[model samples]
Target: MNVTETKRKVEINDLYKLSTAYDAQLSPDGKSAVYVVRKINEETAQYVSNLYVVDLETKEERQWTFGEHLHQTPTFSPDGAMLAFVSNRTKTNQIYLLPVNGGEAKQLTFFHKGASNPIWSPDGNMLLCSAGVKSGETIHTKEEQNEKKELQPLVVDRLIYKADGRGFIKDTYSQIALIHIDSGESVQLTQGDHSYAASCWSPDGTAVVYSANLSDDPDAVFTSDLYVYNIDSKETVNLTTGQGSFGRASWSPDGSYLAFLGSQEENQTVTTTKIWLYDFSAQKMHCITQEWDVDVEDVGVGDLHSWRRNPGLIWTADSEGFYFLMSDQGNVGVYHGTVEGELTPVLFENLHVYDLSVHSNGQQAVVGISTPTLPGELYTLNLTSGDREQITHLHDTFLDDVVLAGAESFTIKASDGWDLQCWLMKPAGYEEGEKYPLILEIHGGPHMMYGNTFVHEFQTLTASGYGVLYINPRGSKGYGQVFADAVRGDYGGKDYQDLMDAVDYVIREYDFVDEMRLGVTGGSYGGFMTNWIVGQTDRFKAAVTQRSISNWISFYGVSDIGYFFTEREIKSDLYDNIEALWKHSPLRLADKVNTPLLILHGELDYRCPIEQGEQLFNALKRKGKETRFIRFPEATHDLSRSGDPKLRLDRLTYIRDWFHQYV
Candidate 1:
């Protein structure tokens, strides 16, 4: 086929056709790897994830398990004889097992709140998982209550009584449980008012390491201490001693040490996640990445697969060190870290390694990588030589007909003398001498980076004949802790100038960008910046803000994270610095916004509640300014990334149409 013939514009609906790979787990022999590939069912408009296995030797791949429901968290048995995964096919999500060689999956558990994160015991005769149940109730009783016909009023008691996606916080607490494979019997391991996080299976199979606050008031404390629970003795021992928030536990091959990722800082959200090693002999914890400036996980946010979880701490066979993904600058790379605080780059490239799995021999590794042009795919790599071979052709057929824009990364010095990293994606089918409208895109997280990853929204904007400009402003991770923390107390100060300077750099340097037809858009922190940008200047013709924060005063009480996030990030308290909070609030300057703005928010978004959008929309409308607000029902703060498939598409459509209408 000719070059132009291969370049077809990517459509919004193409989101349904793209397949995403996640969580690759290598077998004990390292000859095979199984991972979850998620795709949208066009007919049902729902995301369905199924297990897929790949032969590492011949590079042959096949679907290992299939069902209409979501299948995820695939883990290999100790003997590599069976594969256990969590599936929602049953009435509730439960553990299911399928023989490695070949067989139908057998449902293993029937817990009321379902089971997840299945880890097989060393003996391969049992599995350990977590399931939510009432504080003092049995699974059967809870299931029976759920199956009851009569309706009852919901009683709220806990300080944290509600979550964004989950409307009301039920009394159920996630507990650790052990399930026998042969007898189909399950035993509860730990139970309390507190919920347990994911755990690591001890090498000898006698214990499991888990994390929980276990505090008298969990909502009042930010500590998540690691604990070891003896399966035989049923005794729990605290490992972290409530020093800091810690989780993502990984046991050494010989069980001499346990490694996890966390921070001991008081300002938890702004603190960088570093690797911590707990020595069994000394009974002490050491921060292995204390000198390392990078964030020790995949925090480079994206829309296509924001639900994607980091591979966590993957231990090498010898237990001398481990391989982990660290966010530095604009890339998340796999790094080999020694127990002695040394980090060696293994796969440090202009790519996002979201998840990875190393072989038992530590010679071969499977990685989930995404680039600006590539959505996401699984690739097998030779750890010694760093040679990678793409093993899956999931979206090959679909991407063949898609025309992706060329992304160029550049660095510009902000007015405050900080080097800001930015990327510019040219519009698809660009001609040599033609000028196109540009959309200045800001990423949420003010802490998240606009890295070298595939962002579907940016692609969709480029496909619609717009150049996309995205920058990693201050307060954005990957650029050292200092640069990331720079915006904590100065939200609209230097960070705002970094974005403006990035836009000016592109407009001044790039000849093909139309200066008159400028557009701006972002979600969350990006949304907050978009609101601030239009208020500060009317250079952009239009702007779209999603799940944005408008008023810090009200946000302190209304947002799920309002109380602390406001005090921590903004460095302002409602009682003392109420005026300062209002000063930085975008809603305070709403009367100055002249650019046609569109506010999109999730109705159930507790992170940045819909009230934030409502306030902005009301302010602009009451002033007779051009503005619009669109709310996605039952959608949470993750609407752009993991919300309903249709709603995500509609949100993209709204963004494209809004920019088209003004810019």
Candidate 2:
């Protein structure tokens, strides 16, 4: 092969491909798979997702869904005769059935409430799906509503809940429903004035084991419990009764036992829950991998796997051994485990892994893998031999000419004496004795982690001729819970020290860093930290904060989950200790800031509303500090991840320009 072929890259417009890749589900026999393809066009300003099926043996592919309507979540019936999926072709998300052999699809349900999570019964006669309307909305027939109580204002108990991202105006409750294939009538499985979701049909198809916070205090929406609904007995049983978050419950294929994930109620610290398995015969429960050594990443253990199915737990064909995604060092990989505790590695990813789906045959799988230098693409993996093959070439062309930077790993001791692992990505063509601007990048979820994987933004920023330093710092996962929770009640205390220490260590050791031209940027919680950093110190020349929080007092009432998250993380209640919140608010120290700051926000961002951006920008402006704010109208909290492809590229360009201009 030519050298050019060896370095060949893919692009978004490649025929039969997409700019963004998403869910891929394999056929029962593992001989075929259908995946969702997302296309982004520069000319039409169009982005669309369509369904396509690939025949493994024949290498033949065909489009299964068409038209302007979007389709997703396609599943083949057990017998492999029909394809069932949820689509918005009719302008509402509804379930439809089509003969896989070939032909038009038949629309099933007709409720104005709409439907979601289309799961076919094992026998393929009845489809077990979750259908609902908006919570607290009056569910009345057209005639009844015309003659009865005009809709009253909906009152919600919880501080945070999900609003439908798309579909018709929802005015109903969320609940699990059973769709009769013949009659098309959806029977209310579990019903109440309260909301419930994330359900899976039991092994015997007689009931559904799901997680809910129905009885949980609305103000405190974190607690949940495992509840089973019996279709035959018309009974709902609280299996693992407690005020804990229990989720992703799956039944053993034999119906002899059930497996799920749960954490204790003792502390509010964010950590991975153990995989819990309960045997009906013994009426006892045991955690599959409770050791400090392992963490659950996906769903079931064996051949076919399912994660939390959008809402709750559901079992898979391979329940004999549990399989989960985990990270050790910087590597994230798949591991195999027996329900009794025997566990082994399947795939230790050298890059970030996503979209991992297993086949019932237990021999093959598909996943999206990325390294610090790579974007992401689908790859096929062989289970037995640990072999991997690239299945999709999504963006090779844009990357070919771009000389990407690779990660250089190192470590430093935090001021608190804790050893902190760190990594640096140098710009392409980096040379010794050349001074370079540096950007300290932090990740969000303070509970989430950044591992050894390909991050496009990291590469893109480096290519713009700057060194990027990313640190997990304290409160990051992968390390034990103690280390992860080190900054719990202390936001800018030790965790802030850990970050500054990393920068100090780098500045002391790396002569190429122009300390006077330093910059800092992060998103979400990272955004909060960025705002805090600029306010606390004027060491950095420039700063950028994305989806950030400025004032803790206002965040508690404005941002989604701000009501609960602030109380838990910031540990200051508005009415009880409003002073502490003011002290911790990044805006409080705005007077100390001299660095030029840029605030990027999404208008539809309920997670950390755009008001946070306005507050920070207004604060810096009032203090006579340089500040700018840009907002994406249709974007949400995922402005970086699932934002418009063109806009995502534009945001990266903006960040690069701001840093280059000031630093």
Model 2, span 1-663: residue lDDT tens: 644334433222222222445577778778877777666555655556677887876757788888656677787887888888888877778888988888999998665667777777778778877666445432222223455666676555545554313312233556776888877877766666555665567666777776777764645556778888777888878877764677777677777777777776344856655677788888777776667543455311100111112222223466676455665555666666667677777887566555667775567876666666665666778878988877666667656544557888887999879988788887656789999989999888787666676566676667677888888888777676677677677888888888999999888999888888788999988999999998788898889899888888898887767867788787878898999898888989888888899889988888788898998888788989898899877887776766666666667777878898898
Q: Over the full model, what C-alpha lDDT does candidate 1 score relative to the true structure?
A: 0.88
Cα lDDT of model 2 overall? 0.71
| Candidate lDDT values, in order | 0.88, 0.71
TM-score, predicted candidate 2 vs. hidden true structure:
0.89
Runs in model 1 lying further than 4 Å from the true structure: 145-151
User: How would you encode candidate 1's per-residue C-alpha lDDT over 143-251 as one tens digit per residue?
Assistant: 5644558867988776577777776767877888889999999988777688887568889888899899888877778889999988778898999998999999999
Candidate 2: where are CA atoms >4 Å away? 1-18, 67-69, 134-172, 298-319, 399-401
